[model samples]
Each structure stands twice: as structure tokens, then as C-alpha cells.
Target: MTIRMAQESDIPELAQLYQETVLAIAPHYYSDEQTHSWASFAADGVRFREFILSGTTFVATDETGILGFAGIADDGHITSAYVRRDRIHQGIGSTLMQTLLDYAKNHRIERLYAEASEFSLGLFKKYGFHVYDTEIVERQGVEFKRYLVERGVIKKD
Candidate 1:
């Protein structure tokens, strides 16, 4: 697999991946209503495309197609991170995150933050992120329990 910056052309595939990941994995932590509402965001083509294009988004892909994607905003907040349902546990998400972190470090970002799901919290923790807060986020009338995770910059010699 390869990791690269995402482009406008990747919007459709990214949306599909986001929807699939939310539907398949969110059930482990969220209720059916919450997962459905969250996944529905991916169906908004205009909004989804705009969001992807507005940040430093990266994709992990190969000959088969998109394996995963992650993105960070200008302010050092991770906007999204999703791995295709079938490809989870294969290092796709971690690779995509590392790619984003590398880009952030190159750009002189000092820290990174993300509103992480219960499942994603562990992944962020593996990379040195710690929860600073717990919040109830709502989307389409459904509520989600999420954590605000942050990691400071890791200076390289």
C-alpha cells in the first residue's frame, strides 16, 4: 500500500470508505441510531468534498482501491480518520495517521488534537495522545460519547 495526499478526485471513494467504516465499526461503541446518523454525513457530497479539500487529507491505497484515509485541519485538529471495514487491524489507519503527523511536523505544527470515538481513542493513545476531555457530541439528533485527545509535537533530532 501507499500513502499520499488526497485530492478532489478521491471524494467519492473517501465518502464510501467513511460510510462503510462508520456503519461497520461504530456499532461496537455507538447505538444503531447514532451510527446511522453519523454515516449519513458521508452522503452529503458537497459538504464532504468541501471538508476533505479544506484540510491536509491523506489516503492509503493500492491496486484494489482506497484502504483508508485521515485528515488534519489547519489548526492541528484531526478532522477525520477512517479505514475501510475489511482492512482494519492491518496498519492502514496507523499508516494514514503517521502520514498526517509527518505532514504536520513538516509544516511546523506544535500539537495535534482530535475528537475520538471510544475505539479510536486507543489508537491515538498508541501515538502518545491523551484524553483531555469527554464530550457528548450530537449529529442528526443522535448523541455520541467521544473523547478529546491531544498529543504534543514530537521533536526529531
Candidate 2:
């Protein structure tokens, strides 16, 4: 797999991956209604392009196209992170996270934060992030619980 910065041209594939991941993974922690409501925006490639262009986005891809992506804003907030359903447990998410972390460090970021879904809590913890809040977030009349996690940047001596 190769990791690189994301460009606007990657939006469509990224959007599709985001949708598939939510649809496939969210059911483990959310109701059908909630999952549908949540994945509703995945088809909006324009918005995805705009959001990714506004931050430092990275993608992990191979011969099969985009496998996963992650993005971080100037404020050190993780805007999005998703790996294709079939690509899970293959280190794609972790690779994307490492890229994002490197970008944050290069920008002198001291901390990072994300509103993480139930499916992502374990991954975040694996990278040393701590959950500071648990809240019920509602979308399109459907409710689901998510965590607010943050991690301080690690400095190498």
C-alpha cells in the first residue's frame, strides 16, 4: 500500500468508501434508522471534496484504488477517517492515522481531537487517544452515542 496526500479528484472514491464503511460498520452499534440517517450524506461528493480540501487529508491506496482516508483540520481536529469495508483489519486505517499524525506534527500541532464513532473508539485508543466525553448525537431524528477523544502529540527526543 502507498500513502499520500489526498487531492480533490479523489472525492468520489472517498465518498463511496465513506458510505460503504458506515453502512457496513455502523450497524454493529446503531439502529437501522440511525445508520441510514448517518450514511445519507455519503453521496455528497462535492461536500466531501470541499471538506477534504480545507484540511490535511491523506489516503492509502493500492492497485485497487483508494482503500482508506483520513483528514485533519488546521485546528488539529480529525475531520474524517474511513477504510473500505473489505479493507478492515489490514492496517489501512492505522496507516492513514500515521500519515495524519505526521502532518499534525509537521504543523506543530500539540493536540488532536475527534468526535469518534463506536466503531472507531478502539482504533483511537490503539493510537493513545483518550475519551473525554460520551454524548448522544442525533441526526435526522435518529440518535446514537459517540465519544469525544483527544490525544497530545508525542515528541521524539
Candidate 3:
């Protein structure tokens, strides 16, 4: 698979991937209502497009198409990270995270942070992110828990 900067043309596929991934993974950590509410974010084309363009977004793709994607804003905030449901646990998420981290280091971003869901908590921790806070956030009238995690970008010589 190849990882590259996401193009405007990839939004529709990315949006579908995001929604499918959330719906498929959230059940293990959230209720039906919460999961649907969370997935609803991808339904808003305007917001989704703005999100992809708001920061540096990367997509992983191969013969099968976009397998995963991740994004980090200019201020070092991790906005989105998701792997296709069928492709989870195959290191796609890890690769995407590494890509984001590499980009951060190259851009001199000081720290990286994210509002991570329970499904992604382990991946964040695996990459040295520490939970600084936890919050109950509401999405479309459904509430759920999310972890606020951060990791300093350590430049390696």
C-alpha cells in the first residue's frame, strides 16, 4: 500500500470509509445510538470536506482502494484517524499514525494531541500518547466518553 496526501477527489470515498469504520468499530465500545450519532458526522459533506482541507490529511491506498486515513491540523491537533473496518488490526492505522508523526516532526510541530475514542485509545497509547483528560461528549444528542491524549514531538537526530 501507498500513503500520500489526500486529494479533493478522495473525499467521498474517505467519508464512506470514515462512516463504515465508526459504525463497525464503535459497537464494541459504544451503544447503538451513540455509534450512529458518531457516524453521522461523515454524512455532512460540507463539514467533511472542510475537515479534510482544514489540515494535512493522508490516505492509505492500494489495489483495493483507500484502506485508512489520518489528519493533523497546523496546531498539532489530530483531527481524524480511521482504518477501514475490514482492514483493522493489519497495521494500517499504525502506518497512518506514523505518517502523521513524521509530518509533525518535519513541520516542527511541538506536540500532537487528539480526542480519541475508546476504539482508538490503544493505538494512541501504543505510539506514546498519554491520556491527560477524559470527557463525556455529546454527538447528535447521544453522549459518549472520549480520551484527550497528547504526546510531545521529539525530534531525533
Candidate 4:
């Protein structure tokens, strides 16, 4: 797979990947109705497309389609990072994250932070992000507990 800068046309697939990831992991952290509502908001075309078209958005793709995506804003704050459900544990998140980190470094950003869900905490940690704090993020009447992970000006070549 390759991690490349996202295009406007890729927004739909990118949003779909994100929604799938959230839905796949929601059972571990939210009630069914909450999960549904949360996922519904995530599928919002306008919002998701805006995110994908923002500061720095990247996608990991193969011949089939998008497998994962990550978006960074305000220099290095990771706004989103999600891999397709069935494609998890296959290093796609790592690849996409590494790409974002590199983008940050190239942009002279001194550090990067990500508000990551429990399902993705380990992946962030694996990539050298340390937990800065924990907070409850709410959307559409659903609450998602996550870690704020920050890595200071780090990127692997």
C-alpha cells in the first residue's frame, strides 16, 4: 500500500473508511444507539470532505480502494486517523501516521498530537506518541473516551 496526499475525489471513500472504523470499534466503548448516532455524524459528507481537503490529509490505498486515512490540522494536531475495519492490524495506520509525521516535520512543525480512541491507542504508542491526557469526546449524543498523544518533532526516515 501507499500513503499519498488525499484528493477531493477521495473524500467519499476516505469518509467511508473512517465510518467503518468507528462503527467497528464502537461496541467496545458506546451503547448501540450512541454508536449508531456517532457513526451517522461521521458519515456527514460536508464535514468529512472538509476535513479531507484541509491542511494535511493522507490516504493509504491499494488497487482495490482506500484502506485508511489520516488528517492533520493546525500544523500537527491529528484530527482523524482511521483504518477500514477488516483491514486493521495490517500496518496501514502506521504507514499513514508515518506519512503525517513526515509532513509535519517537513512543514517545520515541532510536535504532533492526536486525540485517539481506545481502539487506536496502542498504534499511537507504537509510533512513539506518549499519552498527554485522557478526555471524553462527544458527538451526536455519544461519548468517546480517548488519549491525547503527542510526539515532539519526530519522524522516521
| TM-score winner | 3
How do the residues 1-157 of candidate 3 rate in per-residue lDDT, one tens digit apiece?
9999999999999999999998888998888999899899999999999989889999999999999999999999999999999999999999999999999999999899999999899999999999999999877778888999999998855
Task: Per model, state how many residue pairs clash.
Answer: 0, 0, 0, 0
Task: Give the poorly placed runs of model 1, Cα more than 4 Å off.
Answer: none
> Which regions of candidate 4 fall more than 4 Å away from where they truly are?
155-157
lDDT of 4: 0.81
Alpha-carbon lDDT, every model: 0.88, 0.87, 0.94, 0.81
The 10 consecutive residues of candidate 3 with the worst lDDT sum are: 137-146
Model 1 quality (TM-score): 0.96
In candidate 2, what are the lDDT values of residues 1-89, reduced to their tens digit? Answer: 99888987888788888888899998988888989888887766666678778888888999999999898999999998899999999
Positional deviation of residue 28's Cα in model 4 after best superposition, in angstroms:
2.8
TM-scores of the candidates in the order shown: 0.96, 0.94, 0.97, 0.89
lDDT of 4 by residue, 16-124 (tens): 7777777888778778877787678656888777777866788888998888888899667898888899988888888888787778877878888888777778888
lDDT of residue 71 for candidate 4? 85
lDDT of 2 at 137: 78
TM-score pick, better of 2 and 3: 3
Candidate 3 residue-wise lDDT at 109: 93
Each prediction's RMSD over C-alphas, in Å, is 1.1, 1.4, 0.9, 2.1
User: Residues 1-157, candidate 1, lDDT per residue (tens digit)?
Assistant: 9888898889998998899899999898888898899999999998999879898888899999999888999889999888999999999888988887887888778889999997788789988899999999778888888999998886654
Q: What's model 2's lDDT at 67?
A: 94
Error of 3 at 132 (Å): 0.6
**Residue 116 error, candidate 2, Å:** 0.6
